[model samples]
Target: MNAINSQKKHVFFRRVSTAGQDIITQEAADLPFREKLSDDEILIINEIATSANKKAIKERPEMQRLISLVKDKKVHSIYAFDRSRLFRDFYEGMEFNDLRAKYDVQVIYTSVGNGNMPASDDVFVEGLLSMFSDIEGKNIARRSREARLRYPAKKFGYQKQKETKRFLHDSSKSKGVQQYFAALKEISSLDDLYKVTKEYRKKLKKTDEQLVSMATDPFYAGYDLEKGTNKLQHVTPYISIEEFLQLQRVNGEFFKAFLERKKSLMCQNIYTPCCGYCRKPLFYKIEEESNSSYYSCSSKLHPKVTVSFSDLSKIIGGILSEIIQNFNAEKLINQSINCYRTIKKHLEAEMDSIDQNLNGIIEELVLGSDDYSADWKQDPMYKRKQLLKQEYHNCLEQIKENQNALQKNKSVIKVIEEALINQSNMNPSMLCDMLINGIWIYGDNLQVDVFYFDYLQEMEKEMIFEGEDIA
Candidate 1:
C-alpha cells in the first residue's frame, strides 16, 4: 500500500463517449477504475473535465478542458477504456502525441494495460485504432446519406406512418403549409408575403433564407434529393407537383428582383425607418397589377398607413432642394471628412487596446497559466474576454460603416452640385441614396429626414408632408 501510494499519480482523467444505458455493460464506469488505477489513484469526476458525447470533434469544450488540465500539470495521466474514447482521427492522435511529448503526460488504455510511456509497437497500435475509428465514422455518414436518398426523411409538413415507417402528409400541420405555399405563389416578393402573412410570421419566425428553402424544397413535389427524372409518388404529398414547380419559378423571380432592389438606396433605409405610432420599421412591397412600389408600417395596429415610393421621392426631393439652396455643400463635405477621420482614429485606438488584451489572454492560455477559474463560464476574466471579442468585431463594423458614410457623403456633394447646375436632369434614386436618412409615415402625414454632413450640430432636417396632397 505504501509503495502504491508513492507510485500512483495525483490525478487520473477518465473519458467515455457514452455514459448512459447504451454503453456496453463490460465497459461501464467501474471497469476503468478496476482495470487501470491502483487503490491509491484518484479520478477527476468533474463534469467539465470529461466528454461523454458521440461527437469526436477537437473543438468541443470538454476536449479543450481536458487539454488545459494536461497542459497546466493538474493531471499527470489520462485513462480511457479504449483508444477510440480519446480520439478517432489521425490529426487529433498526432496532436495528443505532441502534447504528451511537451508536457510528459501519460495516456493509458486500461483495456490493454500499456504502461507509462507508449513504446513503438503501442504507437503503431494507437494509430491503427484511430484510423479504423475514422473509417467507421465516414462509412456511417456515407450510409446515412445514401439512406436519405432511398427513403427520404420526413420534413416540415410530414409525419411517419406508424405501421410502415413511410412518410405521409400530417393533417394537423398541412393546412398552414398549404396556405404558406399558396401565399408564396400569389406574392411577387418576400416583402409582400411577409406583410400578408404577418400573423404566420409571428408563429414561425422563419428568415428569408429559410422561407426560400422551404418553398423550393423538391420533397413537397414528391421528388427525392437524388438526381432522377421520375417522381417518387409513393407517399402522400401536401402540395401538387405542378403547383410546386410554379412556386419554384415564382420564388426564383422574387429572389432575382429582391437582389436587384437591395442594391438600390430605398431598400437600404426601408427597414431602418420606424413608424411614429408603433415604432416598427416600415416594410416595402410592390403592387402586382400596377407595378408600383409602396412602403408601409409592419405594425398590425396601423396597417392603413402607407406611402408610395414616387410620393416619398417627391417629398424628399423638395427637402433636398431646400438644403441645396440654403446650405453650403463644399463646407459640409469638408466638415464630414474631418468628423469621419476623428471617429475612425478613436475606433482604431480602442481596437488596438482590445487586440493587445486578447493577445495577452491567448498567450496565458498557450503557457497553461490562464488565470481563468475552472468555472470559466462564470469567471469575470472569461466574461471580459468574450466582451472584448464582441467589442473588437463591433468596432470593425463601425469602421466599415464610417468608411461607407464618408464615400456616400462625397458622392452626395458631387450629385448635389451637378443637380444645381443642371436642375432638369437629376437622378432621384442617387439623391435619395446620398442625402435621405429615413422616412416615417403616420396616417396620411409623412416626415422625411435628410442627412446633413456638417459636424457642428444635429445633422438632420425633418420635413412634413400630407400624403393625400402629395400627388
Candidate 2:
C-alpha cells in the first residue's frame, strides 16, 4: 500500500488459501469500484497462498500491511470479493470493523466466493452468518490438525522412516541419551546433574528447567500417557519403560539431597551478598580434604578473602549475645506497637479513597444507563461498575487482614523480646540477617558493618513470622 498521509486511499484486499487459486474473477468484479478512484487513492492488497483457517489476519503478510494502513487513518474504504476473503471468524470481523470505525473507513464486499453461499445485504442476517462461519472455520482447523496427527517430524534420539513413516531410534543420539539416563543413578545433587548435562547435551541446548521436563517426559518411554495399552505412539523406546521408572527414582533422590545440604548461613547470601574486595557472590562449599564448610567467593582472587563456617558461627553468636545483653527490649516493643497502629490509620484512609471513587463511578453509570435497552449489560459503563466493585472488595479484604496483623504483631513482639533476654534462646541464624549489613574478611582483620536504622520509622519486616518460634 502507498501511504500518502495527506490523501485518502481506497483498498482492494483479496486472499486465497492455496497457490493454485487466484483472485482474478473477484478483481474483475471489483474493477468498477477502482475506476471512480484516482491512481494515488488506490491500494491493492493481495494475500496469495495464505490460509485464513491456518493463519490469523496478523500472521498473513498482506493482511498485516492493510491493517497498518487502516490503523494509520490512511485508508478511506476497503473492498473485498466477499466477507470470507477478509474474515473466516467473528473475532476477525469485529476487529476489522473496530479499526474501520476508529479511522473512519468504509467496507464493500463485491460478491460471495463461487456463490455456494450468497452474500446478504441485511446487517442482522450478516451477523448470524458471521457467527456460523466463525465456528465452522474453527471446526475445520481442528479437523485439519487431527488429520495430521502422525506427521513425520520425529523427537530427539529418533528418526522417522520416509517410506513407512515409522519412528526408529537413531543409533548416534540413542546411545548418548541412554548413557545420560544411566548416569542419573550417580547424581546426588543438581551440580552433578548439570555436569552430566554439559557432557551429554552438546547438541540439545536447553534451559535447566526444560532439561528436567524432558527427562521426565513419557514420550521417550515409547508410549503416550493418554494412549492406552492398545496403542503406543509410533516411536521406538531407547530407554525402556522400566528404565524410565528407575531414573525417576534417582531424580527424586537427587532433589532430597540438594534440599538437605542447604543450610541457613547468617552472612552468606543476603547480608554478605558478595566478596567486599573481589565483588563476587559468596557461596558455601565443603573442603574435601578437611570436610569443613567455608564461605568463599565464586571468583578466584589473589590472597582469597574467605571465612570458615565455624568461625562465622562464633562471630555472629558473640555479636547477638552482646546486643541482647545491652538492648532495650521494652522500647522496641512500644515502638513496634505504635508502628502497627500508624499503618492501620493509612490503610483506613486508602479504603475511604477507594469507596469515594467507586461511588462516583456508580452514580455516573446509573445516570447514563439506557433503561429500555436489552444490551445494557454489554455497555462499557456497566463493565467499569463491575471492575470498581471488585476493587472495593479487594481493599476491604486488605483492611481486614491489617486488623488481624495488628493483634498478631503484639504477641510476636513479646515472644521476640523474651527470646533476646535468654541469649541461648536467640538463634543467630534468625537475628543475624536483621542485625548485620555486611561482613568482609581481609588479611588478618575481620570487618563487620552493623545494619543502619531509621529509629523513628523503620521496623524489621516479620523476622518472627519468617523464622522458627522461640516462645
Candidate 3:
C-alpha cells in the first residue's frame, strides 16, 4: 500500500486504560488489524486514563484532535482493536457512525481482540457495553455519595500505613509539637482554642471558612479511591479529632443557611414586577373592604404616592428620563430662574390690565348706570374681571413652586458630582438592581423599561470612547 500511493496511508489507532498499560504492547497485540491494512499506513495511539464516559471523550484532547482530523478529511479510515477502546458508551459509538457517514472514515476492528465481535453483532454488543458502562458509572457515584455519610462522625488525623511504614506527624522540628501544646494550654476550653486558632489563621490571611471546608473533605483521611475501598499505603492527620467534629457541626448549619438563601434567590416571586413603581419587591396587602389580595410596590403604599403603574404615570416616567438627559443641573437652574422671572412679569402685566378694568366697573357702579344688578348676571366684563384676578394669583403660585423645585434640584447636583468623581468598582448584581425595574412579559414579546436609562447611556458613551480592549 505504501508503494501504491503516499497519500493513502492506513492509520492504526490504539488506547490504554492507564499509564501502566504500555501503548507499544497494546499495538503489538493488535497486529492483525495492521496486517489487514496497508503496511504504509500511519499509526495513531490515544490513551484515556479515566473511564471512557461521555464527559471524558468530550474533554479528552486526543479524541478532540481525532475528530478534527476526520473533519479535515486527513484520515481515510479509523482502526481500533475494539469498539470499547474507541468508546464503551453507545452515544460515542453513534458519534463514530456520524463521522463515517459525514467524513467517509470507515472503522476496522481486529478479529483477535475482544472488541472483534462479528460485524453482524456490533450493534447489539455496543449497546450492551454502553448500558453496562453507564450502570458502572452510576454505581460508583452512589457509593461515593454514601461514603460521605461518615464525614460528620469522622475527624481529621494521620495514620501511618503498614506498607509505607511512616508516621503522619513529628513535633521534632523547632519543637513545633511542644509549641502547639503550650499554646493550647492558654485556652480555657477547646472552643476558645478554636477561636485563637482562627485569629492566627487571619494573621496568615486564612479563614474559618477554609478550616470548615477541610473538615467535610474526605481526601486527607487516607483512602486512595473515593468510590472504592482502595486505601492508600500511608496517611497523616493534621487536626485533633475533637476540633474536626466541632468544625463539622458549625459547617453544617452554615451550609444549610446558604442553601436556603440560594433557593429563595432562585424563586421569582421576590423579584419586582413590571407594573409596579417601587422598583422593589411588592409586599402582599389585603383590601379590607373587598377581602381581596393585592400586591403593591413600597412607593405606591407610602407617603405622597409619588409613582403609579397607570398609563399617564408610565408616560411621565419616560418623560423624566428624557428630561434628565437633556437638562443638566446648572443649565436647568438657570432656565428655571429665567422662566420664573418671565412668568412673574406676565402676571404683573395682567394685574395692571385687571386694575384698569376694575376702575371702569367702579365708575359704572358709582354712576348707578343702566340696571347694574341685571348687568352683573349677563355681562362679559364681570366674568373677565374675576378670571383675570384668579389667573394672576395662579401664576404667582406656579413661579414660587418652580423656584423651589429649582433649588432642590440644585442640591441634588452635589450627589451627582460626588459620584462622577468617584471610581466605579460596582458589583454586577448591584448594577443590575440599579438598571432593571422589572420586565413586562406581553404575550411573546418582552417590554424592558430602565429606570436609569439616562445614566446608563452616559456610561455607555464614555465606555465606547475610552477605547479599552473589550476582550
Candidate 4:
C-alpha cells in the first residue's frame, strides 16, 4: 500500500519481555515520541507485565491486534522503546518486516541514541534472549529445583536428598506402593483388585492412576529415570526387574501406556543498508511447519541472497562463545565499570560547575556602597536576590540528585563486579548490549560487529538527561 492508502498516525507500543521488568523504564525513555501524539493521532498499546521472551509476537494478544492494524494499513508509524520488545524470534522478525514493508510502516526505536540502534533489530536476540532465559531460568530453576529436591516430588513412596538430588524411600508411601504392586500380581479377580486399589488410594491419598503408574514404573522394580538428574541404579524394588519387564511385555497385563510433554543481532557493530526497499535487518529464519533454525535473507532486492554457512545458529553460538572468551569474563565487566566511571566524572564536573555558579550568585547578592539599606525589600535588587536564592536552591537539589545517582551507580558497580568475579557467569543480554553492536547484511555477505562501545558514552548521557534509575 502507498502512503495515500494508509493512515498518517503513529502507534506507540511498549512491552516488557518478562513480567518482572517494569514498563515505567520504557515509559521514561519514550517521552519524546509520546508527548507529541495528539489523542487521536497516536494509538498507545501498553503491554505491561507481558513477556515477549516467553510468547512469540503472534501469540501476544496486544501484538496481534497491532499486527492486524498494521495489515489494514491503519498505522502510519510504529514507535517502540526497543526492537527486543517487538520481536525476539527470527521468523517473527521476518513476519513483522514483511508487514512493515508491504504496508509502508515505519518502525522507530525511540531509545536508540548517538546514532546507535538496538543490538538486535529482530533475529539473533530471540536466541540470545532464549539463552539468557537459559541463564536466568537455570539459576532460578536450580534454586527452586534445590528447594523441591529437599522434599520428594508428590510421587508416592520416595523423598529427595537435599544436596545430592537423590530419592530415598519413604517407608509409609513405599509400603502402599509395594502393597499395590503385590496385589497387582496376586489378585486374579478384577473386582478384588478394584477394592484393594480403592482402599490404598484413599489411605495413600493418591488416585487410581498414581497407584497403577507406580506398579508399572520400573522404580518399584528398583530403577527408573525421574527427570533431568539421573536414573535410580539402586532401590528397594516393589518387584524384581524380571517382573517389571514381564508386566511391560503383556499389553493387556498393565494399564495402557500414556505419555505427555522454543533465538538476533542488529545494528552498530551491526550495519544494514536500508533495504532502500525495506527497513528489516539481516533475516535468519526457519521454514514454517518446522522448528528449525534455517537462515534466509528477507531482502527482496537481492532475492537470491542466502547464508553461505550451515547451522547459522551454531555459527552464532560459536561467535558468542568466542566473544565471551576473548573478553575473559573481565573485559566486559571492566568496560562497563569504565563507562560508569566516565559518567561519574561527568556528573562530578556538573556538580562543580553548579557550585561555582552558586558562588557567583552569592557574591552578586552582596550590596555595593551605593546601595540603600531601606531599599532592600522594595527595589529591583530584591527581586534579583530572590531569583538568585531560587537558583541556589535548584542547584543544591540538582547536586543532590546527581549525588544519589552516583551512589546508586557505586552500589550497582560493586554488585556487578562481585557477580562477574565470583560466579564468572556472564549474562548474555549484557554481552549483546555492551559488545554486540549489530548484524548487518550486505548484498552477499553477513557481517557481525563484535565491538560497539561508542553508544555506551551516549547511554551515559541519556541516563543523566532522562534521570534513569540504574538501581
Residue 307 lDDT in model 3? 19
Error of 4 at 12 (Å): 2.5
**Cand. 4 Cα-lDDT:** 0.57
Q: What lDDT does candidate 3 reach at residue 18?
A: 55
In model 3, the runs with Cα more than 4 Å from the true position are 1-9, 17-21, 36-39, 48-51, 54-58, 88-90, 101-104, 111-125, 137-167, 170-210, 218-247, 255-471
**lDDT, residue 375, candidate 2:** 80
List TM-scores for all candidates, in order: 0.45, 0.43, 0.41, 0.33
Q: Candidate 3: give the clashing pairs.
A: 10-41, 157-237, 158-236, 158-237
Q: Could you give candidate 3's per-residue lDDT for residues 310-337 as a string of tens digits?
A: 3222332333343334435565456666
lDDT at 363 for candidate 2? 81
Candidate 1 lDDT by residue in tens digits, 366-448: 57655545665775666778999999999999999999999999998888577764542355556555666766778867666
On a 0 to 100 scale, what is the lDDT of residue 169 in model 1?
75
Query: What is the lDDT, from 0 to 100, of the residue 459 in candidate 4?
Result: 23
Q: What is the lDDT of every predicted structure here?
A: 0.64, 0.67, 0.50, 0.57
How much does candidate 3 score in TM-score? 0.41
Using TM-score, give the best candidate's number: 1
Q: What is the clash tally of candidate 1?
A: 0
Tens digit of per-residue lDDT, candidate 4, span 211-312: 666666666665543454343553445678777776666523425422110111111112222222243554544321132333345645654544422333
Tens digit of per-residue lDDT, candidate 2, span 316-364: 5665665555555556667766876787677778778877877887788
